[model samples]
Target chain A: MLPVFDVVLAAAILVSAALALWVRDRIAAVSGFLVTGLLVSLSWLRLGAPDVALAEAAIGAGLTGALLLRSAHRIPCAPSKALPPSLWCAAGALAIAISGAIVWTVTSFGAAPVYPSLVADNLPESGAQNPVTAVLLNFRAWDTLLEIAVLFVALTVVIMVAPARPRTAPLGPLVQPFARVLLPLTVLIGGHLLWQGGHAPGGAFQAGAVLAGGAIALGLSGVIGSKLTRQNGLALLAIAGLAIFALAALAAEVLTGALLGYPAGEAKTWIIAIESALTLSIAATLFLLFFGPAERH
Target chain B: MSELSLLVLLPFLAATLTVAVPGRAASLGLVATAANALLVVSLCREIIARGAVEQVIGGWAAPLGITFVGDGLAAVMLAMTAIVSLAITAQAMSTPGRAGFWPLWMATLGALNGLFLSGDLFNLYVAFEILGLAAVGLTALAGTPMALRAAFDYLTAGLAGSLLILLGIALSYSVTGRVDLETVVVLTESSNGRIALALIAAGLAVKAALFPLHFWMPAAHSSAVPVASALLSALVVKGALYLALRLSIEGGAGAEFLRSALAVLGTGGMLWGAWNALRAERLKLLVAHSTVAQIGLIALAIGVAGDPLQNGLWTAAALLMLSHALAKAAMFLAVGRIAEALGHDRISGLNREELRPGAAEFAFAIAAISLVGLPPTAGFIGKWILIEGLVDEGAVHWIALLLLGTALSAAYLSRVVSRCLRGGPHVSATAQRLPWRSGDVAALGLATGALLLGLAAALPLTLLEVPFA
Candidate 1:
């Protein structure tokens, strides 16, 4: 029964991915993308990677789908030019060859769990019960720090480009009431995610996205102001993650003897502090990316 | 702080600070770049005295956490980056940029530092991501319709390149269970490993704007502001090319096939870029195209010096990169000053007597001489070493191609040089006074450095003796 479900879900995923690529209408293509995202998240769930499944569902499926839908509304859908038959045939063949090589390589990988056992061994001192969180926030915090910097750079680029300001028009009276209820719930869940990150699947990214979702809701309903403009404070908030993370990493180096090293046994406290700041910074940056430079009233 | 970490962190912190406080961004940029240059100088000194400097981030060792390694090659490249960045930063200071430019430039500096120092494949990918986005943003800062469109193409190309690199990393991890640079030897033992490496090489080639994969480079680099173009043409592209060289050296057996292929592609890029540059009407476009030609030359050097054990040949390649970075950066900054005074960069219009060519023209002449590999410049020394190596190996065909590339560089550069010196009819009664700004001084300083580097060839040669890996 489990195998059957897996096969069906995989098939659905493939179909939706193809649909996303081949669909002519923008709306339909986006719907296809959303479906594929959901199915992919479901596949993650079936693989027993609940953390990945949650991320895929929240950020990958939900936020990405929303962004796509919004973009689709702005751009007119046109029929994409079909490639020449010879080109298509060549591409197909190349894809097959590459896929075959990949499959062969994966199957022949030696019977070791690779980094997992090593990660487990070092997990205790890494300050988080959850290995993934430990890796992200402590062990390999440099990558995470740079990752947020990537986000911050993207935000900076978008602000520099200054695209058309997004409308803050309410979705009518219905959205106000809906947002009023949803906003509080989002904050609670987001905070919970941040706190739970030490021992579970939740972390700064997931929590930040949830908070951004709430901000987006308020933005859509004409509450908390609309049309994200470049405010000095907002800009500060946006870069807060990079600033705080760098300072923390440097301070750690000074206090301890190594870059990004935590003080003995007090790792959890530092990680949480960094995460909370990152949560706010990420939320602001992503929210601003979704919203254009705030409209001057 | 460990010098290795400071190499990446200092610029990153400065970039954030620049973003936070944009009021004195240009000045702050100058100060930061100066400090960063000093740091790089110290790093190079340390690498020369010692062997290499390695630091583990977050107290986690390799295969679990990233490491920063600064070796002879990394030191040379960092020094090159430092020189170019400082010159460009000084030029930018004289002519203030848009509010967004300083931070993006600083971020790019940080990213380049990270790229050169990163000892792990995945960490390099993150660095590439930051580098790519910041570079694209810088390209679009010109704010022209053409600039924006080109930036979009660059963004797409960069993303595709990064995806290929990421795919290669994934494959590598699955096979060797390590994304560290040290795993390259183990990676060469299998066909899958070879393919993975090829993918990585291809991705880096795209980012470096090697021929055929470089459709977005000319327009993007040519259309950007002068300071931005100087950085983009000189330092940003080298970041990727540096990676390609590192991979070939570390990749052991797997690199043999790729090296020959790179040589073929590189030779093609050399001639093709020269052809385009010779035909380019706009001065900036000509400079940008010349970059493609120069990159081809460096890539050819890397391809030829595929074996790390061939110390002299490999060191020659590093020297070539060093020479190109300095000369090309000086050329771009000179072009920027010219464009500013003339109010246009049309190559044909460069002869106007009303807009008399001053110190900027002198700088352009010197940079052009270096680019053409004339005597008493770093370019000549580098090319001479490369040709000598080719002679020893009896690779006469490559020798001929290298000479032909030199002649073509001379020919194309002379087009701009002669035009700058030509006398044109005084069209406007109101003489557009080409006041000497500090930007010209920066250009002259860089050009002088390139010339001095040729005379001081022993310095870099000594630094390059420390074997990579």
Candidate 2:
């Protein structure tokens, strides 16, 4: 049963990915891409990486699809041009070479480490029960800090370009009921994910993406769309995660000589506090991006 | 917090603050920049006293934790970055550019600092992402349609590079179950590890704009506002080159293939970039192209360094990078002032008879001297060490290539210097020096720093002798 499911899943992912590139219609292309992301996330789950799977589904598929859909109509599709025969041949050759090299390298590795040693041994003092959470918020929290900075950079760029306020037409009456039902469910699920992250697969990124999804849904129904411009409050919300993380890093360093090191047993408290702030910031950033361009005031 | 961490965090905090209060972005940016400069000074003194220092985040040792290493190499980069940022920030203060410039630039500084100090492979990728996105934002800050389109291309290229780097990290992890600097030594033991290094090198080449992969760079660098151009051309590209250098130092004998490939690509980029600059019609494009050529020269230096763990030749590459950052930023700022005064940046229009050589013109001339590796300048000291090393290695062919590249650089940069020397025909005997604006002063100050750095080259050379622990 597992073997059969894997084959079908792999085939579906390839088909959707091909369609994502081949489709001429923007909406269809984005949908195809989103489907591919979802399938890939399922594959990650099959590989026993539920944390990665959750992130891939939420941010990689859901948020990216919404972003593309928002900009679909504004960006006029260019006429497709076929490449010359020689160029096509070159591209094909290059592709084959790269694939061959990668396969050779992968096969030589024998087996993936899955989770390298030392991680499990050091887990007890990591402040989080879940290995993924421990790695992200403790062991290599510096990478997470830089990752937060990366998100803010994206937000700042979007604002710099200040794409038009995007006259997104309010959705039909059916959307109102959908949002009413989804919004409350979103808050519950997001809160649950944030709280469960210390010992489970749910975390700030997934929770934030889920919350952003609800916000986008409500905005589409004209519930709070126009009011959520790139105002001061929204800007504060967007930057809060990175600012909080950086300040926490400094505070941690002051308390302990090592950056991001919590005092012995207080790791969970710091992780939860930081993740809570990150969820709000991440949600705000995704929501702002979906609404299209922080219009220049 | 360790100075290494503070070097990164302070700018980040300022970036967040700047975004929060756009009206006070300039003052906040300057203050943060000054503090960052002081931090670099502190870090450098520590590195000089202590061979190299390592900070393990959260007190988690490597293989699981992220570490920041402040060796002589990282110190040199931090110091150059700090000094150059000071001038760039002062210029940005007076320029009053796009509202996002201050915040974007602050993030960029933090990212560069992080990129230089990161000892973990995955953390380097994260730093690269932050630097890449922030750079693209700076390029798009010009707000022109062309700038926006260029920024889109840059974003595409940068994301591709990041993906390649991530793939490399994943592959390396799969092979060795590790992603710290120590993995560089372990990666050399197996073919799969070699492939991982190649993949990472390929990504860095794209980010560094080495020769064939530099398609997105010229347009993006040439079209941005002056301060943005200075930061992008002088510093952002260095993040990738610095990583390549770090790999060579850590990988040692096992990474010969990557080093040689870098040298070959560096040679190609040097000539290709020079050839393009000689042909470029705009001043900014010429300066931007010069950056590509200079980066190639540094890459070539890295290629010939032969196991940096045993020899100090790679310090030549580091010196070249330091000299290039200062000189290139000065050139861009001076170019900005000249363009402002002339109302256009056309190379042909630079020799305005109505104007005599001003402070900006003099600054450009000094910067050009440094670029061409002339005497009494930082660039000359770098080239000196580079050539001396090449001679000792008895690589006659490499020496010829170096000379040719040097000549090519001089020929192209002279295109602007000659124009700046506009004299005889134009009746401007009574013309006073053009009033120095904030931009001109910044340019001249940076140019002089580069010029005087040659005399102080011993300091960085000694610092480079400090071994990484």
Chain A TM-scores of all predicted models = 0.94, 0.95
Candidate 1 structure quality by residue, lDDT tens digits, B53-74? 8888888898888888888888
Per-candidate TM-scores read 0.97, 0.97
Candidates in order, interface RMSD in Å: 1.4, 1.8
Q: Candidate 1 clashing pairs? A: A228-A293, A228-A294, A229-A293, A229-A294
In terms of DockQ, the best-performing candidate is 2
Question: Model 2, A164-209: lDDT tens per residue?
Answer: 7766688888888888999999999999999999999999999999
lDDT of 1 by residue, A1-297 (tens): 999999999999999999999887889999999999999999998998877887888789888888888778776655578899999999999999988887887778532536898799999898899888998988788888889879878988888886666565667988888988999999999999999988988888899999998988788778777524456787789898898898899899998879999998999899999999999998888788877676422
Which consecutive 10 residues in model 2 chain A have the weakest lDDT in total?
A: A109-118
| Interface CA root-mean-square deviation for model 2 | 1.8
TM-score of chain B of each: 0.97, 0.97
lDDT (10s digit) by residue, model 2, range B93-128: 877667788889999999999988889999999999
